[model samples]
Target chain A: MQTESKSPLELEQCLKCSICTAVCPVMNNTDAYPGPKQCGPDAERYRMKDIRFFDESALKKCLNCKRCEVACPHGVKVAELIQTARRDMSQHGPGLREIMLANTDIMGSLATLVAPIANFATGLQLSKEVLHATVGIDHRRTFPKYAGTKFETWYHRHAAQNQGQFKHQVAYFHGCYVNFNYPKLGQDLVHVMNAFGYGVQLLEKEKCCGVALMANNMYNQAKKQGQVNIDSMRKALQGGVETIVTTSSSCTLNMREDYPTMLGIDQKDVKEHLGLAVRFISRLLDEGNVKLVWKEGFKKHVCYHTACHMARLGWNVYTLNILRQIPGLELDILEQNCCGISGTYGFKKENYELSQKIGSTLFNDIEATNAEAVVTECETCKWQIEMSTSLPVINPISLLAEALDLEATQKANIR
Target chain B: MKYNTVIIGGGLTGLVSGIQLQEQGQRVCIISFGQTLLHFSSGSFSGEESNTDVQALLKNAGIATVAGGYRLTPLGELRPAALTLEGYYHSETAELKEKSFAIVRLPKYLGLPIEFLQDTLTAQGREVSIITPDEVVGCPAEVILVPACKAGYDLKKTYGKRVSLIAALPPSIPGQHIHAKLQQYFQKIGGTYINGDKVVRSTLQTDEKGVRVQSVETQNLGDELIVADHYILASGSFQSEGLQSNYDHVWEPVFGVDTNAPEDRTAWTALDFFEDQPYQHIGVLTDEAGHALVEGRPVSNLYPAGHILGALRTDIQNLNDALRIAKNL
Candidate 1:
């Protein structure tokens, strides 16, 4: 069943308990924020009486991390309230920077078309300064580089021929990050699935998960993308695809949690299929349906940074459990800390400093662990952590791919 | 999906118990409906003062407790309470009776009436002075009673423990502070907390010995069954809906545990509104082992704690009882 819609009367449920402030990462880092208690249900009472009572800038400062929602004893939907307020306040439409960042699929496609020039241009100081001045993207941050070939294109050339031959079938919803920026992760996902005797194919025509769009207050665009993704996923499911899996935790959470709850895609079949879209590694391990053949002498020290949405989705344990299976691989989990690059929120020049400040704890923890490399489930977290630290951050699936004996899979692929 | 223990509420008792169980290396998960009643707490724990064991447990959880001999209530009358996160006005001993106090009132601050406080303090044979400060900083009074505002301003930092915050009308600051600390402590020790979901129904297994809870189902998370070896029902009293009363009778809603209450509906409340009400003590009666009983038979795996234990004066007894039952577990 879907979660009941929170009514205006639910605002009265706030006991004025300032408990939300204590656990709020944003409040802990900066004094500029009035904390979720004040900005959410507290201000909501006033806003209900008069829409003029809204504080547009203060509301934007929220990371929408849902830490406040978790800390709230009364189920205040503090993050949802802040997001709704941002949506209502931006009724006139979002700024140019927001509009640009929200459309990841378009930018990703164009960037991949001119991969070398785009990657080189993003690295140059002069280009960064010019882009910052024009588009409000922070100059100091390093943009994720686009692959020479997108995942969909690579899949057609390499992996698509082997589809439908395996005993198990899983439709991969490779969100824009894995599709354009890190196609290797998508390839790794396919290789790992194929090694387990499961055939992997891309969803018929998936769109961006729309997490950035929803965060940027582009509700209509997010809804459209959600509908398209759902339809594509439904088509794949109808064609005997057993499960829908994703490499990114944020994208998985968007389909599993935000779609029905926030985006109003509550059709019975859609909800059932959405339930099938489990975290890739967790589902495989939990069902006990696949056997992982760990390569002998494969060992490394891996520190995991649990992405906020992954933790909220309750898949961090799954990631940890699967990673720990590697023999002699010493795993250290960083404290539950937000990476602070929440979709497009951290990309803005105004939020660059706050984003870094919020992520500093995670960075320091990673450095302290002295792990050979860092692993996380969310691509946004991967980019943020890698940019902030010297260690290379990779997905768990990529790490899993490395541990597999690729000779066996390559032989199977040749057959 | 499976844990060593599944605690029903996320209030002070449920959280504390969860932490204790997790420390014992049990996989614990706390399922909560929404806002805990602790939001109405005055941040004070008042009970049999000699029970240092419970106080030690609280201290172990990183919550510093002060003697808090007597503190002025919102009604202006002084009452005995054992407070946590003590402000300046909350004295550990009765020496506060001899001290000169100034009640500072801020403009447009309607939390506490200065005249009521003055009258109550004067009635207690203490001299009281009232001042309306333009700002809380640089006040001349040795001890100032200010509004209970914790955000945007830190009275303790500004006035250095000399300023004691009074409980505001509703969302109490001290209560919120303690609740946050408890939650953080519980999580730090590897306890899982699931908020914003209510346990709609529980699957029960009956055997020759007795009945035991097999798994619990929640409202929002569809089709996911939360299975635990042991279940702790700390859902609290009427405030959080642990115990429900209709025109005919009172009963625990979640498990339908038999409640200890007067059979007559007329005996539920007292004649005076300020006096102790009988219904306040009506809750799930438990066995000597703290296992909740249904129709005079104990559910071997179900243990009841906190306000749901049918104790009188819940604020005083909930924590102590919770600690006692949780330690034995």
Candidate 2:
């Protein structure tokens, strides 16, 4: 057996051009970050010489948005450099705020058990203030409310019985956001897939994709959860699941890219098997094998917000392409800007101000669009945009579910 | 995604061709892998007198340009540049040999060739003077020139209309500016740009129209073949990864288009660094219409533009070639 490597351990490929620095939204908004150049490759050169060369505080300011990686002409894994540095730093056990944010599955389960009480308490202004002072979550931030029913619980009860009747089966990795905060998105994915003649089932075992855990600097926990996710996806693929589609871009990115790079988990076999829902659907549509029937008079002036992870994933085009099919959908794609909410980073009081400042550019763009609602593939961006702007943020899959003709789609895609 | 045109590479040629097609009411998409050679540009463009047609298109996109027969190269010589960014020095390469120039020098911003510039102009039967940026007000030269290095911001803004600038080495801010501007213009005009994504393969169909690319799939979009009625391979040279090589052979990676290079890889380069290498001229073989070829046959809908057009390329006939394709269609 090959000994596992924990980090990407990539060589230094920075050209010292500051191009990454120019694109870094955090550096443009705040001085706390020395920028991606200094934070990633530059710091990496020193980190190799001695452990103390690692500057923890400044590196913590990185949104880990992967914008630097996307902008680098030399293809330097700039974000990987920053993440590996954070992963290697002497393990200070996670703090109270970090623990509360990082333990998504645990917190989500407990919150779902008492979802109404949790939502009420979290939404209450007085309770928000108390939690802000105690737990360090920003009082201005509104936590995405827990659902009355978890997606997995609802999936097993309502959808599981009907899934076996379909010939084509695929597993769905509805992440923590879809599992706890919104089961409606998971149900929508099921409906959209079923309409296309594909049955969506749950993975044999699913865990949080560990995006929040990694952002919280809980790398070890993130690794364990990443391995679990990859293993589950691999097993599902082995069981002849065509692919695993996710409603969350972050979960898809984390599973396909971050797992191998950040956690050093072997996901090559299952990497291509996982993607956002639109990616799979759009591919089939492009090949002219499957057809999606659209509803009549389903009109809405909507704009697509390319979340940072979705941009980094470079799959926003797939989502946008699928959305353009709605006959009356006057689709306007908003300029890509980071929403500054990199997982749980925006909820922390310290980053709350910087996060909002960085996201203001995007919020301003949204305000100018006069769009009825905002569509994005990332749930965190949904939180950030909804909190900052008056627009209700939605997933493309959710919009497609509404726009796709149920009876016509089922008939058209029956072949 | 389906479109009227799908062009690989979002560099100068790709964006220009995309913008031209987009303005003509064709749905266009340009897929770029990493940052293009645009980041390495002088932020200035050089072409022929005929290039003025395409120059006007750039002007509509908020790009400011001036045309002279020639432009000031980084090495302090005049070269024929069809279109020049406003605020950059230019001259008639041979006809206007008498105009004097004032090359501005700033401490710690020693990106310019101070001695070579003065000597070359003096050799060219013209008066050349070295002056500080502050002396631009009283300088006697016809043009106040500065190096396009990152000493500060735009020279024209600081020193007024008399000011001009020359190209710099890689990672020039002005280069990035123009690239960002053109890309923004392309997107603004409803052309979808897929940055940081590369076309990995093509689904080809050959009929009476020749080998047509039915669809082109990208790295990020995997098996999702982006179908287009017409395709353009503006994806740049070996440096930009439009073409790649191993010890065995040199080939175009994206479409496996036919490339012209020395059979022996050993003859690809020169022993000395300064010498022009054979590999530099190596690129995809194209038909008269500039469509890229596969297995020695022209792909009907696949048009090759920019540096991928090989030694025939006249940077530095990029706009002309792109305009040629756009105008033909």
Candidate 3:
């Protein structure tokens, strides 16, 4: 008998059953790239002897959506295996376009500084053509408009002082999307939390969760940012704030799961306290610690889309439970399909066509539902769905804030 | 989160139970880890033998099985199976009475045991000719047989001929279609199905109703409990990780349900390789009404359905037991 015990995700457990290949959205859309089975365990066995055993070119087409991992009955980390190989076999570093897309916090901060000019220039047709030619950002894509006032700026000025009166306090990690593109989601999260008698505080320092960085093969930069985020969580936990929540599904997945596995960041101390806002709040409601009272005569119809990352996190059930609790909300759940805009994957010129093709099934289904709006948890999904379809895609937290009876909830939850 | 019922597995039995419970207006949730073993089948379900609505239930999902009472195996042997994908080869008798047959060799495919099938058919005194897809138009044969994988399901309509398909090995396209349709139908009817998660722990309280499950915890839903009025353990047998084994013991991993495992390792198997083995049939213990047992006491609210209850191997038996249990709950 061997002395060592096997990890649950050992590569030897792969059954070579091709179920991973079936669930891969990338493989189904493109023949240029082999499926997860070929790129992952099938190649890893050969690559164990030498790194050059398999060609690394086809690995680039992977969307890193982690659906293969979700579909594997034996729990093999197919996406992680492919990603680790990319990290190891990569000979060339990220180019200017990748760096621009990967460093989300830096670009977000710069754009928000000159929000009006940045939004106008980014949306201009001539600028799109020039950037598509020079920078390789797809011309057909429109950038997420930067907020005029950042969430941090607004939070410090407006909501920081009044937080001290609440009975319980929790830290918020409003990620780059909330900090730069949409401050309203941050405002909504605060409204939902404050109504539950919980004080929401920002971390002393924060950085982009670096999901985009990792996908772009910028592991070192991702690790650097991941360390910064972990340190802020450590300080927050030291101050007795046990739970730190976020609005973005990708950020939560990056910190909770991908940090130690992909970037080699030790998030052991912080993972337990870190979660999505839906999970934390839904747990509170389940345990009878809080209740949500919606506004009178409120009625809305929305189709909830399961973002790829949200499905990987397995916390979509919590978000769905929260949506189902609304008295007048007519919720229709769309089948879980990858919207094909996996963060920066769909924004590149070469990937532009393939991404839309991969998402066509979802687009058709959403049209069939014809709900008034689309609801989802990931900001990137919101960006993809809203760009592809004519309907507005809003986050679940925003929906809660829209219908929540702030006065009644605040009075009821005064612990 | 709370529901009227929570199912441990999302395979055939668990899904049937969930559908039955939801049809009764009981809010239901099913926690499934990875894909089910339904992917290993060729859309072969066996509930037509029982007085159950399983045939109609599956028909509503657009997965109509052939009406014949037999199925053609990939190895050219005919077996009795109540259900097969609509276009598959199924007949009433074991023998293919057709005088001449053409088996189209699916190029670049190895899932079917073609050589073994040819050898078996030739020994049975049947005229079998292997032909390429290019020769299908000119080939003179009573009927044409084709492998299902790596080929379209609408072979009959596409070729405008007497085409019969057989399921190659898994990943079975026909079976996956069945699962996807049923799962979609389940969700469309308001049943909540949480994918890629498993229940890891359960809290049991002994009240007037002899030990009841108060709540359960899942691997992914950390620190939160899934509270339900009733729970079903349909996590499949050993191959599916419902029951796990170590050096000397076999036990049910979820909820610590009592299992019918031999204590000593020596008693796990028979002398011959093909002989019956104790390990293959090992599973959790449940009372007649399908209430799961712990330490010989039945948990009043916890029911064990499907193959996890042991002594169940056929699709009809699983559906009948799952439906009967769901109705009692």
Candidate 4:
């Protein structure tokens, strides 16, 4: 925990303005969580004597919402404050749930053993509720079930299909969620890459990007995790992978922006990765790199929900611009503030209702659009949208690669 | 109302005038709508004389030591007055200390936070410190930062960008539009201001002790009594109160505010014309005791201040002159 050194004069300037709260979708839904201003500087004012406190459930409730930062008049850094508070609580003996959540590297490696058992465990009606209760998670949400086969297993088996695509190749970073829960998205990404005439190599020997750990305020752990990820990316770059492509928006944002400040990685290399590696499935197709076989008679209306992490990294417009190129697809740009799932946020039982409330705006927007499908770059957003709406929510590349008539993509979708 | 004195206009001059009177153990009631100072203030003080020869003219008009800038030595007595001043020139070291700790104005549209900005600057090896005054009424930064003055709105969030909040008094979009609304609201909240009430004549009520300003006739308000133990004349510059020469004699409305002004506005105008002309000498005559001169006798309470009555140009520099006038009062 950081030493309490900020003065009362420093704390008094907050003015109790709820502008920060107004923008936080997490606070909009959850009653237990005071918005950023309240939990942050507002709460900082009323505490007796010092800033140190024991329990920090209120501080950890921030869904990593960047909206409050945008709405603040005084430019109060609410996100950093919340993260610091969480770090303080974690140091004061963070419970087993937090430790388990923060150590994704351990979880990622254990996926092979836990995959089937996890599915069976999650199948029990009371399992998720019990897990939420133990972890301080709100009781009304569901997590994505683990995939039958992990993404790495699939990537290694089909390594020889791209005999001689483009000389230029990209290093693929399949994040934990895409690797465990939605492995097919990674497989679809390969097909999309091949059609675009690029040599795509999966950096299967990668660790958790640790962005989630950082969000949960496990800074030192996040730094260590970031170093491992950075080393893997650095090696891939040395092996002639010009750009690092990843399906996860959170992973892309971390590698592109956060890693440089947090880990002192080669800033130029990171920027190059940002300029090129940071791309969505629909974006690759729009860039004319991926060959899309548009379904002969399929004409559909779809809305794209820009993810908050992706939006903060400034990749939102690029995704939207790419979507504009599809011939028969009518796109509704859903100005979603946040999906409110934010990885683990929606799955927590305590936050589930708040997540639903925060997500209601997006849910209503998707419903109002009356689109046949909802397309987004993030798998968590896809899951959150799927939970609320009856419309099919799929990865943007899955749609684009299907349009390209990739035989494997067609085969996978039919199943 | 146990008011020993009622000071009108809540701008810098008025506030300082009241502060000085309060320090002197007098009960001072300041009537202000609070939109007197222009929001954009640099807060520098230079004490140089304007070319207008107003001090010399006032001297010729039989008034010897009109209050001006002083370089206070260790002895504490004000030294010989400097003619022209700029920004907020302070004669004492105490005032200089405040200026060094002044916060730079942070403009809007810079999408960086104050801490981040500070970190970035510190990384670049620049020494930047911020200071806040005691009373803050609105949008305080993550740090409880206050403006240099009451009307100082532009906050320093970045190296160079101005930021201010739009109060919802009149409800408009929150930029310059809201600022305009607040300014109008300030005018309304301040004491009675009959719009377009132009003062044209001055009358003196002389007694054994001193000459008192009896009343003045405005074009609209007619004869309004400005009765008080003290009077502050801060009607602003020529653009605000019109100090133009009709034939040859240079004069101002009500009490001949700046009696020693240039016969022709061209004489006081700048060579660049566009550049700020140094015309601090264009002001009313005053006796050596820092009292206003009515025909040759000192008016006990009538005080000339700000851009209107000046030994220095307030625009280019004379902030210290304004401060001194307020402090001495």
Candidate 5:
């Protein structure tokens, strides 16, 4: 692990402004982290106090929501700092959290081996509490139940098709969680992408981005993961492909924002390549390059939960704008704070309530909109929203995919 | 009760003209209605157009005074303080005369911060500066502050993120949100602010005889006249009554000074679409010594400034022009 020599001055210009905290849904909901200002420079200042062992648990509560970055006066890169800090604290300090966060590949292998037991354990409150206490996850937030079948296996079995529907080839990055748990969503992404003129090529060999490790406070492992993803992306660039779309907002943010700075990966050529590869799924759908077959008389009001990472990255507007412009769609924008699913943190028993409380504002807004369904670009947010509200929480790309069925419509017209 | 000089419209042009008239030890009063472009302005001044032909168009209009005339070579730029229009009007030299201004195009979502843009331009160019928000934005150099057309609510959300509010008028106008926000931020940071007052009539309140303006009675309550030897009218366009425009003539409000404006409204529409419009060239005429002129006659103590003037067809073209006009005033 290469240590960053200077630690980039620890964001001294942050001014301890509470504007970010005031807007932060996580801070509003959870006492696990004392808001962004305190977690950042306010907490960073006490580092010189000669305190025994930094309580890096504060770092884990950041849902990596970019609300602070948007509200910051000096435009401090808050999300990047938090992610970096998570990595730093995890690696520098020794713990079970480090092992869990750092060793995602091992976790994936073990997850596949004991898939049924893992699912069973996820259902039990005792297992969840044990995992949270052991891994430093606040046990209040709810996580998605892992699908028994991973995305790739299902894709090869059900969807490997020249279905005469998908036309262009797109490089799909099945983020670890999507690859292992929600593979169908990945398949749906490919199907929708194909419907929008892209033929799906699963970059099956891609590995973990170390985001979990970074969250677990393992910086070095996360950087390695970032480097691996960057190399994978670079290979796609050499293949002359331009668009790299992913269903994971955090994965994209990690690759787009964290990779270059943390790993020192993505040199000038790779940087440009990564920039092209760095788009979320909704951005691809909104590019106006693809023609979507409009579903006639399909009426639904869509309220968007602006995912934190996506909001900070400014892609939420692109998603909202595209959804609003869809032929048979009506979109109501909801810009609430974090959904309180700081990824795996919500799955832990401790963070569960905090996650729910932080997400309460969003839930209220969603209910007020009374939207037919809640739409989000991030898979994590989709899972969180679905678990919280019984309403269908869909990724925008999946909806667009369903909308692009030309033959079914022709048959309907013929009938 | 009449003053030696009456300038209307509380915009930069009237402010400068009044300052100049007052410095000459003449009696001056500037009356204005509400708001000025200065508050919402990104204060960079430029006369360059994208097309060389447009530059030629400016020259043909008799406003181009650069060395290349209308054909601005890379070196060609306007030096406003050095320019003596019609060979007579000389107020004081402008502060910007020592600094040349750079023209910058701001992005749609991001604004060109007025202070930042001014500093950046002044740092890059020669002496003598005036910069205005370009025609693309359609904002005029008037004293009225309204929501920008594209993102009216966008700026209101950030009313005083950086700057402080000094004063506001009508206090209850719909624009008070901007005033309130600016006031909140500015006052929180110890910036002084005044509200609910208007300058109605101005005269020399001092023995040295500077422009002194008295607040006049209006339908609105709690109005008092202000008396000052000099005045700055940041009051905006005809819509805000900074300058009164009618079928027969154009005039600055408090001064009753006739503007050397075009007789017809058709001259106001430079081009059809908003983007290509070059209406800023049409504004009030001034003599060589920078006196407001109407058909070759100078209106004594009445400065036709800001959008009230006829020579500038569009008020939002450039801030330097107003600054230059202000310097001359």
Candidate 6:
């Protein structure tokens, strides 16, 4: 069954203002892809008249960053229209590379079992070339290294020891990146939450948030994953999970906004439960629910790269507010620009150069700051910034974890 | 969550005020809904000639501005513009009073109609000639007006100061350029900008000293409240939806602040379309302190600026009021 289109009224609202074109990062970087105004509402009008005119490959170039949507004063769902066009165009089937990128959970789980070998093989230039020739992954770009132990595995073995000690409970939705590539981020999140006397429980069964799938035009597969994740989250909520939390800003955005808007999961209860999901550390700090005792003399001058998803999600303020609470940490909030990795978009061979170009401004700004460390919430952004700059890029939770008095927490854990 | 000041718009006023406050060592955050009216602005600010302080402030912020004057519109008719960016040609320096100018109309250019522009210029007692861009190689006319199409190419460099750009309509490149610069400056000065978040409703704290806003609820992020010591409501006028009106009454939706408007609907619009309309004056009523009123009483910590102050042409008045209020704070 086809997913219902969001709204034609939204398409009609476009005044051909070109505001979307002005703000679109993808358009600003490359001429190969027509900007959002042309691909979104303008092409949408033609697609409504004759579906045959929809260009799949051109629409595929869209980063689905939603900057265009935010820039539209008339409230046109410009990104949605482009996504819809791509969905309709890809009705036949997606490519093998698209499928592999979309099902991150499956690849991630398999890769984690033999992570050291997998990481080494993917890191090798010849292997990357072979993979690129066969599977269309970029030859130059480095894939995120899979963790030796998945976050779920580590949580069950180690962090779950003090689960029931706290009254306030949160079901953590550690997205595919944290679960597979950087389980340490998830572990840091757990430590930070535990420091605040809140028990962090993993969702019983969670799938990939399908941001990659949606961008790659596998809308149906993305929707299925969305449903699975929604079901898992609902089950957790039924079991007395007060709130659901995600360490990844993109995952939080997917659950909160894209589930209903893009995936057509219009159930009122599920939507309400999805709304309860917040970016883990930022929400805790924003609500003043977390009491943090920073380890004295933990000084670091860090520059923050506001992830595109985090900026669009409107939670960068919370991230900034939380970061300021860390004693002796100086922060330089970098100018807002797309780091241009944009999940898997930067991973494809065709997009590699454009991605780097788009991210040039951000890289220059970071280098100019001469920051000791770069902090960002999205794992993809962390990878992108780290790859672009020599500086170590970390999630804000990791910084919080570093400053956290884990010894005091262990003493409390002993009780 | 709490800041020294929380600005509720990311337009010129909010950004400028936030930047000024941040430079003063105050923690500031701007909660913006989306692309502001700055995207539609004509890339200039106009008002009373006495407003040099704000112009100097803009200059300090790295926005080069020239003296206020007239600029040619897309129709070739001159319109009043003040304190324009350095690159734009102004009539104050152009001296177009009795000059013969050529309008370079590009081929298949979808912007302004050439005939209409010719008519307007001809009616204005100026000699006008229409020519394609290539014909400009040996044009006799000393001055030329071209569409602001060439992204970064300065027409003045090739054609000298005699070349001026016709003001494009909304979603203008010049406007977007200025907006990005302002936003970049704001962030550079240590101000936090929260974009794509609408201020839904505000929480009011009531005590013996009357009422003050405690926090504001945003559309996204469910129950997370944004707390600030002071608030600036520069959400803009009806075009930006800072003020909302139904068939019966107009109201400030966020804080439910009292508006200064005629209760009767008939008083909304003027009989003459070109004349000043009462509807334009419908906005949040503020006291001398620029604090928005709740019923008849002023909310101590809440200040109103920009178009939300009513009838004031935002381009003319926003920066002046924003800087003045920001200084007083």
Using lDDT as the measure, which candidate wins?
Answer: 3
What are the lDDT scores of the predictions, listed in order? Answer: 0.76, 0.82, 0.85, 0.54, 0.50, 0.79
> Which consecutive 10 residues in model 3 chain B have the weakest lDDT in total?
B43-52
Tens-place lDDT digits, model 4, residues A1-415: 5333354323443545454554577665656776777777766544434556523767778887555543443335566556555654455554566666666657655754687887777666687668766776554555567876778777766754552455657888888877778888888777777655566776636778877677655677777767777777777788888778887777776776667654556555545553323254434544454444555665678887767766554454345545555567787766545877887666656667777888888888889888989888776788788888888886676766655556643343332
lDDT of 3 by residue, B1-329 (tens): 88999999998899988888888789999999888878888656754463337777777767776544777678877777766777776776767777677787876668888778777777778788888777778778877878876463545557754677777888777777777787888877789899988787889998775898999888788877789999988988876678877786788887788998888788978889888876777888888866889989998888887778664478878887788888887
lDDT of 4 by residue, B154-196 (tens): 3322322223221121111222222233222222222212221
Query: Which tens-of-lDDT digit does each residue in B234-329 have in candidate 1?
Result: 998876778877678888888888888889999999999999888887878778887888888888889888888764554557777666667777
Off by over 4 Å in 5: A1-12, A15-17, A29-34, A42-63, A82-94, A101-109, A112-117, A129-143, A157-168, A271-288, A406-415, B1-329
B76 Cα displacement, candidate 4 (Å):
52
Better of 2 and 3 by DockQ: 3
Model 6 regions more than 4 Å off: A1-16, A162-167, A266-290, A408-415, B23-26, B69-80, B91-94, B97-150, B153-169, B188-190, B204-214, B246-249, B258-278, B287-301, B311-314
Output the chain A TM-score of model 4: 0.82
Instruction: Tell me how candidate 1 scores on lDDT.
Output: 0.76
Best by the TM-score measure: 3
- What would the per-residue lDDT of candidate 3 be over residues A1-415, giving only the tens digit for each residue? 6533374346877878788887889887888888999999888888878978757678889999999988888778899888998988888899999999999999999999999999999999999898899979899987899999999999999999989999799999999999999999999999899999999999999999999999999999889989999999999989978699999999999899989988888989889899999998888877898967789999999998988888888998888888888989998888778998899988999898999999998988898887889999888878888889987999999999988998799888995
Q: Residue A273 of model 2: what lDDT?
A: 81
TM-score of 1: 0.79
lDDT of 1 at A262: 74
In candidate 2, what are the lDDT values of residues B1-329, reduced to their tens digit?
78999999888899999999999899999998777777766656755663667778888877887775777777666677667777666665644454788888877565567878788777777788988877888788886678876553555677667777777655666777787778878877778889888777778887876678888887677766688888999888876778877777888987889998889878998999989878889989988867788999988888888988664465547887787788777
Estimated TM-score per prediction? 0.79, 0.82, 0.91, 0.51, 0.52, 0.86
User: DockQ of each candidate's interface versus the true one?
Assistant: 0.18, 0.30, 0.53, 0.01, 0.02, 0.41
Write one digit per residue (lDDT tens) for candidate 6, span A104-218. Answer: 8999988999999999999999999997999888898878899999989899999888889878788888899988999898888788777777788888878898888877777
**lDDT at A326 for candidate 5?**
69
Q: How well is candidate 2 docked (DockQ)?
A: 0.30
lDDT of 5 at A113: 60
List of clashing residue pairs for candidate 3? none
True contacts kept of 5: 0.00
| Collision count of model 6 | 0
